[model samples]
Target: MGILDGMTPKKLIIWILLAIGIGIVLFILMLYLTLKTKTTSLERITPYKESLKRELVTLRPVHIFELMEPTKSNYTYAMSDTNQYYFQVLESETGADIPLTKLKDSIPAGATIYFEKAVNYTNGVSGSSTPRFFGTISYKEKKYPIEFVWGRYTYKSHPENLRPGFTMDLAPWNNRVDTTIYYLPRGSF
Candidate 1:
């Protein structure tokens, strides 16, 4: 009654549309800034691959699940020189594995996962360098590729929600990211 007392139906519609337009623009801008933050942050921290002087260790896939995410899911890259990554591998062979159904055609039948440990963990690989992890799958007489990130066990870390099962993560070897593949533990789908 006060503000719209003399406003026509057409005028009211125009105002509503304009408001919606502004809202959409604001939403897009916020999203852009959030993603940009991650990219910028990583750029500032050049990767120091040589920071860690030790033999590259190979770990077996102990567990597979969704990796942790940030509040805005953008700060995948934080910490200086290194980050405390949390993933798991069995101390002994548990006979655990993901059935072929879950692996789809990506992996051949009668294949087993072989972790290609990345040097991106504390005392593993130092500096911020897009932490990467993956491994190989043995089928027939040949070995195929699979993804596996090295990290601390979530139960021990007591940190973010890392869904159990499988997750496609960035597989950056050195500075080049060859592909983004699912990091799955040895088990059924």
Candidate 2:
């Protein structure tokens, strides 16, 4: 009867013990905001750094003087400035004959005797230019072709005399090269 008509049972047990102490302080503030949002996401993240440091520089191949394959690969454009050099030797395993005087008096100006890959047809700059040195063939990955032979003569003058039976016949060398292309390292800019 309205708790005995506005009566007191000790004010209805002190309003049910102040509503059970505000529901135990809102369940301990919801378990302290769920453990402070998981320790602030495991203290954010920042530790593991070390970047930037490169050196790269290692290339080879550059041998010249050995021609014979021009029936129609295209040629004849000489005006005279003198600097031709386009050698491509890669046919020596045992077919016999490779004597151009055992390579003109210890050749080494840009020597690559035979790796097969040459290009440098010049006049002022029409196509292949920059650095160009040559050599480097792997097949799956690596093709540094550029044995230089544009206008010709990379710079040759030392040949006082030594032409002994210049034969050099590796059986028309042609190591099979469809396309790989890569020549840049004479000066490199």
Candidate 3:
């Protein structure tokens, strides 16, 4: 009562309106500043598009079938209790044996390999063949792995079981041909 004694209803209404207007202005200013800061931070973290293009050109393409084979080592029994699998040396299309140690050098950076047929067994019993694609990319003198599969049906299999240091490609949905490359961190193979 004492504080409002000198203020009429009209003055009180004007004061309230002014305070609201000031608050709205301050809020907008704060929002704008926050968004600007986030935008700048994002720009710093993302790679430049041009640099990515230049790096991609360094990769070479190889056929997966040429580098892999249906040997026992390449075969895996899905849905098995023990996750049992065998390891055999992969071979190139020329019938030359490709040692596991030479995989990194055989497929250079930016190289592509097509795995038309992969050996897989369902229920740890019956074998079914699958198709896959593989590639390698190098950035900053370090190689990043890449892989692609023919369909989603085989995508859910244990990718972790893949040899360390290799990358796999993934599709968003089952039966979709489009693929997105996924890179594993070092030692995540």
Candidate 4:
């Protein structure tokens, strides 16, 4: 009581206002730091999220060629007669027929062919229909099934030549004139 009696009312009011002002400033600074931390954390996670989205949307072509138990040496001679091998190209999603004449010379034996056309995918949607090759390779009066599917990963071996937006040809020929295209089957990552 004795100390309060000496202090003026105006001085007490000023002291109270100054204390409130300091408290307000500290509160605002704390809020700003919290927001900045949250923003930094959001920025850090954005790239990883985008990468995951790309991986989900990106499609890898499926190219599988299984050489039979008894691999035929003279595959070209065996398939000399066009009638021996039945080739049908179909659209994967629609099952529509693609003309065989268009793909005839393009898929030569032992050639790693790349399609001029690029497959476009937008937001996980594929721009072009996948091409499915269904055919039988007959040798010694025995028909062996040879199916080449190009679109999306389904097998363990992912060829380096194959990419998300390109169609790749993996034809293993015994009598290939081109020495550069011949490669032993080693699984790709």
Candidate 5:
């Protein structure tokens, strides 16, 4: 009698239900409008999602044959013959000759070496540097394009006795190949 003297409980419940229904409809309408505006604005310019689609491919694992020490340095570089990928693994502590036995597989003398730094793609229209292999993967072949990047050592040499000499140390060369491939995606963008 104090709060609902004239109105029945059923009538009060009906009014509350109607208010909830109206609120729900308004919320849905607001959501739709917001989505429409967002989509329209996005259509006016280039979409970032669509602009960056190219990705980096993984570097395949190949055997490195011979390791090279850059002139007047202790850094070491790995070599392969069939594949044109040369890689400098780590800085040499003493800057001496890296033994072939220290490598994951024995790099035989006169074995082919391949090393590549990076893959490059140029934008034809803009003449700009497109994302590509900006790093090196080296192999030993008869002839290779050896571009000397200023202020940077293209190869690195590692210490001998890298955790029990070449038994199951797939971590050294294979891991580096994975890392090099990991950067491939950034090259596209």
Candidate 6:
């Protein structure tokens, strides 16, 4: 009664309403100004884009005769598991033999490779006849397991069973067929 003695209830309510409206307006203006001054870049907006980009294309463990993308097959790379940077997935092939000389320096550090193949070897005692491949890839803490099968006993071979066998074309440079396809590991393993 002391402060409102001269003011009617209706007038006091009106003043309160006016103050709230002004506060709202001020808040909106401040927010707009702050937003306008801030710079939002693509990278800044999507910081997770780089790390999760590779996970978007999940390399399934099981597939049915899937062909590697032509463009990607040449470059052969995969995105990082937790970073924006990209890493190369080197494609090393063997002609029933060991693959191209692996260049440790060529591959980026912190990168890992899992490679396996099964060839229908000439015979178990001899070598691979028809190759089937199986592999598991691990990036950071994640793993990608894939299996490629040719026939029976095409992909799975005991780790202790060291019989290196493979069949591959050396890019098939000419029209004439090249017979340097089969690969047999050296030494009596």
Q: What lDDT score belongs to each candidate, Candidate 1 first?
A: 0.33, 0.27, 0.31, 0.30, 0.31, 0.32
lDDT string, candidate 1, 1-189, tens digits? 499999999999999999999999999987665444231111112222221222222222222222233222322221111111322122111224632112123222233544423323222122122333344445456443434333222222223645322222222223333232322222111
TM-score of 4: 0.21
* Model 3 per-residue lDDT at 40: 12
Per-residue error for 152 in candidate 5, Å, reads: 34
Model 6, TM vs. native: 0.20
Model 6, 7-105: lDDT tens digits are 988999999999999999999987665444221112211211222213222222211112233112322322222111111222222121653322221
What's the true lDDT of residue 127 in model 6? 31
Worst 10 residues of 2 by lDDT: 43-52
**By summed lDDT, which 10 consecutive residues of candidate 1 come out lowest?**
75-84
Candidate 5 lDDT tens digits, 23-115? 999999876554431101111122112212233222344333223444213223332222332234222322447443133342333322222
73-167 in candidate 3: lDDT tens per residue? 43311110011111122222234453332233333334322222221212112222222223334344544344323221333335765522222
Q: Count the backbone clashes (under 3 Å) in each candidate.
A: 13, 13, 15, 0, 39, 18
TM-score each candidate: 0.29, 0.16, 0.22, 0.21, 0.20, 0.20
Candidate 3: list runs displaced more than 4 Å.
35-37, 40-189
lDDT of 5: 0.31
In TM-score terms, which candidate is top? Answer: 1
State the displacement of the C-alpha of residue 34, model 5, in Å, after optimal TM-score superposition: 1.5
Candidate achieving higher lDDT, 1 or 3:
1
Instruction: Output candidate 5 Cα RMSD.
Output: 20.2
